[model samples]
Target: MKEFTFELPTKIYFGTNMTEDVLQKESAQFAGNVLIVTSGRSLITYGYLPKLISIIEHLPGNEKVVVYDKITQNPKLKEAQEAISLGKKEHVQSVVGFGGGSSIDAAKAVAAGIASDENIETFLLNGREPDGNVLPIIAIPTTAGTGSELSKGAILSSPAHHIKAGIRGKKLLPRMAVIDTSYTWTVPERITCETGFDVLAHAVESYVAVKSNAFSEMFSEKAIRIVGENLPKLIRNPGDHAAREQMCFASMIMGSNLANIGTCLPHRIQYAIGACTESSHAAGLIALYPSWIRHEFEVNPRKLNHVFQWLGYDPVNDAAQAEQLFSELKTEWKIPYSLSELGIRESMIEDLADQVTGNLANDRLSEKESIIRSILKESYLFRQ
Candidate 1:
């Protein structure tokens, strides 16, 4: 047993209708103004905006709330700054992150940015902590994945820098996180699959990260198992609400696990792919994981074996299970089986590898490049 510390600071409000609960319970803490940040028409068309107005209609004077809806697929620093400028202009005292990871991440930047007129790029580049208390942020997650509700780190991309960076600290954690599984009821089936993959990736990478401890791995192990069992079921039968609910729970757990234990090679590689290809983060991860396993299995069999068992693969002579898990990711999940299948160029592999090596993540960078490059090659050449 190794030394470990455990702390979960976010106030989680979870139920079939917890979104409404959060609006009711936490809305009054802020001043007259509120900024609701969201993405896309579906969430808006699906009642997010209407319900929000209803919530504010009940506020003392029934003042209309301010909202910024310009969040993009993968949040960029410029958009986040734009959202912040809008929030400041509205005199918003509260911020609501009302969609997936991108929206929530944008909301985080908005929350901190609303506190100052200082340049947003300074915060993005310097990691300058927001001074004084920030506007209260409530994360209303519509997706079962990303679990940005529970995480303090907000991933924002800087196109000028062409990299993704996290503004991470306990203070940035949302004051309230409302998890309503019902919001996920209408998520596109493809999003359901891809986001669930994100959950699985978070669990697997965090489970094997060097910083992982028993406390975090306990959550990661259960998260890995539930995701392994339920993701395929949900994909095969998209209307299965029970499975979606389980995946939702597992996603939150895995998100917290990642916050504590951090992530490893697969995430490092996935970042570069996302930066290069402008594809879905989960999609990028699926493209690379098989290769990641192939490259790391020899050196990290114990970790692979544990993930295999969590994934419900028995008969694990560790090495065999490593190969078996890769097969499951390919055959069972039916994820984009290769980087090239997703339109990523073969030439992108080595450059992505170099970007990953220079990435300032939790792991050491010096000796990690070869393993990353080999994984990238494996992803390019992997077969069904």
Candidate 2:
């Protein structure tokens, strides 16, 4: 065991149909005006927005609730800026992220922006660290992936600059997280697959990351087991409430692991792919997994074996077997297994590799650009 420090400041409420009670109990955090940040009108279309607003309005000390529904997929810096502007104008005291990871990430960024009165672009692009003066945030996740609800980081993209990266700080951790499985019941099948795979990615990456410790590994292993078991069930029957609950649980715990140890090369590289193309985050990760896992086998076969065993592959020393199983899983779930499938081009590989930010230290890989280019090229043409 290695020496490490861990902290999870967010109070988590996990279950089905407990959002109201949880909000009522934690209403002090929602005192004064509240801002609700979402990706779009899906919450409104699903009738969740009105219900959430009504609940917040009824909470003790809650004065008003405003909705900022312009958050977009991949959550750009401009969206955070706009939401922060609205929050400031409305005098919102706290923010509630009311959808998937994108909304939750945007909400955190908005809270930080409002509190500091600083443009979030400085943090995302200029390497400015967020001071611990962020407005209180409460995350209400309607998806079972990204685990952004309990995380201490927010991923925002700057399309204008062609850069996507994370803004990380302890202050960015939500003050509270509400995970109601019932809210995830209506997620479309395609999203379900993508986000569920994201859960697996978080677990696997954290478990294998060089920064991982005993505490983080415990949560990572549990999340991996839960994802392997329940993701398949949800794929077969999207309405499996029990499976949904399990996945939500897995997602929540994996979030803690991510906060503690973080992910590996794939997440770092995926940022470049995201910056260059309009690929879903998880799709890029899935495409990069084979090369990543192969690297793990070469550098740390023992750790890779532990991860595969958790996913129910016994005696899995062979990297090819592991890659084959992953390919099969992607095919069954209809997830693309190649970067080209997500519209990434062979010609763009060099630039994509150049756009990659951060170090691969956590992956135990060389930080050389050629290593990264090789991985990208392999994933571009990957086929099982």
lDDT agreement with native, every candidate:
0.76, 0.87
The CA root-mean-square deviation of candidate 1, after full C-alpha superposition on the true structure, stands at: 2.4
Clashing pairs in 1: none
User: Model 1, range 185-290, lDDT digits (tens) per residue?
Assistant: 8888778888988888888777766677888888888888888888888878888888888988988887687667777777767767766556777887777777
- Least accurate 10 contiguous residues by lDDT in model 1: 357-366
Question: Each prediction's TM-score against the native?
Answer: 0.92, 0.97
Model 2 clash pairs? Answer: none
| RMSD each, Å | 2.4, 1.4
Best by TM-score: 2
TM-score of 1: 0.92
Candidate 2 is scored at a TM of: 0.97
Which stretches of candidate 2 lie above 4 Å from their native place?
Answer: 367-369
- Which parts of model 1 have CA positions greater than 4 angstroms off? 60-63, 127-132, 318-321, 357-369
